[model samples]
Target: MRQLAQSGKFRRDSTLLEAAIEETNTEIQERLKKDRIDFDFDPYFAIVRRTLKALAKEMIELGVELGKSRKSNRIGERQKFVSEAQTPFEVIELGLRNAIEGLVALPLAKECVLDLERIKQDYSVEGEWCPFRVSTGNLKFIVDDDGTISISLRNPSETVVKEAKEVLIALASQVYVGN
Candidate 1:
């Protein structure tokens, strides 16, 4: 039922850790004020509290610092590390039913948690592009002398979302970022 303060200047990764703690604590407080949780969700609430409180501890220990001289501490590597730290919070933030299901599957060792968490971010709900990947699906394209362009995605399922088709129609007008 209350709001947390805006984040201050981020001098280090600790800033994010502090913000995560504040966010989870605030969410718990609001739930207590506004919801009927005591009847059934007290244990789950404890898990939520404990997990989100340490959202950054293992990650900070794993070398997600901005200027770390470690070889694997590059920006790309940091992106993966940050995603690992954010998985538990995402179960709350994104309302992902599948993720919650995965978390409930128990008997997993804590050591395996890192790679398992990485799986959570390995994809979008839809899909992604990779230039190196040889797209085996039937893809057709054309570029006319007048520079008109068109593309066709031939999916094996033969079902592409209407939104994706709409996007393809408008794609030519969308300026390429690098260009």
Candidate 2:
């Protein structure tokens, strides 16, 4: 929990530095050595990346265990293999659900969600690379200025990719048409 809190702080600091670098051409070395920042930018990101990687491995292992147990429970019945189940995706979906639920429960978010259906999808052009081909519930999109597009739907069970693709197309089209 402490490391997670520190990681969050690092992320926020990195975001600020990123903006400053863009706006004023700040030196990366200066950012690294600056005592003003709570966390060293490079080391902070390294820690976060390592932690996330470990977490993914642990989640995968837990999924395998659950799958084994589930299969064992069906011993004499119809041999349904839980090993083929959507374990990892299910785990990720649970986390996403919790976060979204929390957001919805917040007074500010609840009040701001008046146009629930019209909520705009936020897009980012830069971030860490995604390892999975598709997600189960959350949505990720990348649309470049040159009309190139890529999307990964966190929820493969739903139409997340299709919806994000449509939005990306609309956004790209608007940009192209000088809207």
Candidate 3:
């Protein structure tokens, strides 16, 4: 019902936690004010609050001197160390996702989640580029020129192969339109 300012600098004494909530709610209300939507807002706020609180915890632990002068605490070296601490798996995953994001129409994680099992099925070049494949699961999919998508049923026995086929068809359609 009210507007929350997202201006100025972050403050230590301000109720940032509450301010974030009010700010998010105000934005959501403004965006949806024209729509005829009947839904609960508490669940959304709960998730936002949880995430904001977690970030607040990280900020506190990182200390008030997070971005202080490099001369005082060697800020550049501290950042280098933090960046270097990431595990190989984390780096690889980041790279893989970045590659997919750059090469494909979909977000990396969404693309991976959608095509992982299907990609594992093995590919034979279809054309200069073919927009679709039929997996062992009989999934109909678009094979990204830049990716090897694997497709398999997480619980093969629980779901029909037709589901994968449907996804593949949808993916192919998107590729056709996007390209």
Best of the candidates, lDDT: 3
The digit string of per-residue lDDT tens for model 3 on 1-179 reads 01121222344423556676776676677678769555568887777677677565445434444434323544211111111222111001111211211111222221222333333445332434434444433433345544333243333432343354345334332222211
Global Cα RMSD, each model: 18.4, 17.2, 15.4
Candidate 2 residue lDDT tens string, 75-157: 11111112221111101111232121110011111111121112233333243332212221354444333323345334344
The lDDT of each candidate is: 0.30, 0.33, 0.37
Q: In model 3, how many backbone clashes occur?
A: 12
Largest TM-score belongs to which candidate?
Answer: 3
Per-residue lDDT value at 51 in model 3:
68
TM-score of each predicted structure versus truth: 0.23, 0.21, 0.29
Candidate 1 lDDT (Cα, 0 to 1): 0.30
Model 1 steric clash pairs: none
Order by lDDT, highest first? 3, 2, 1
Better of 1 and 3 by lDDT: 3
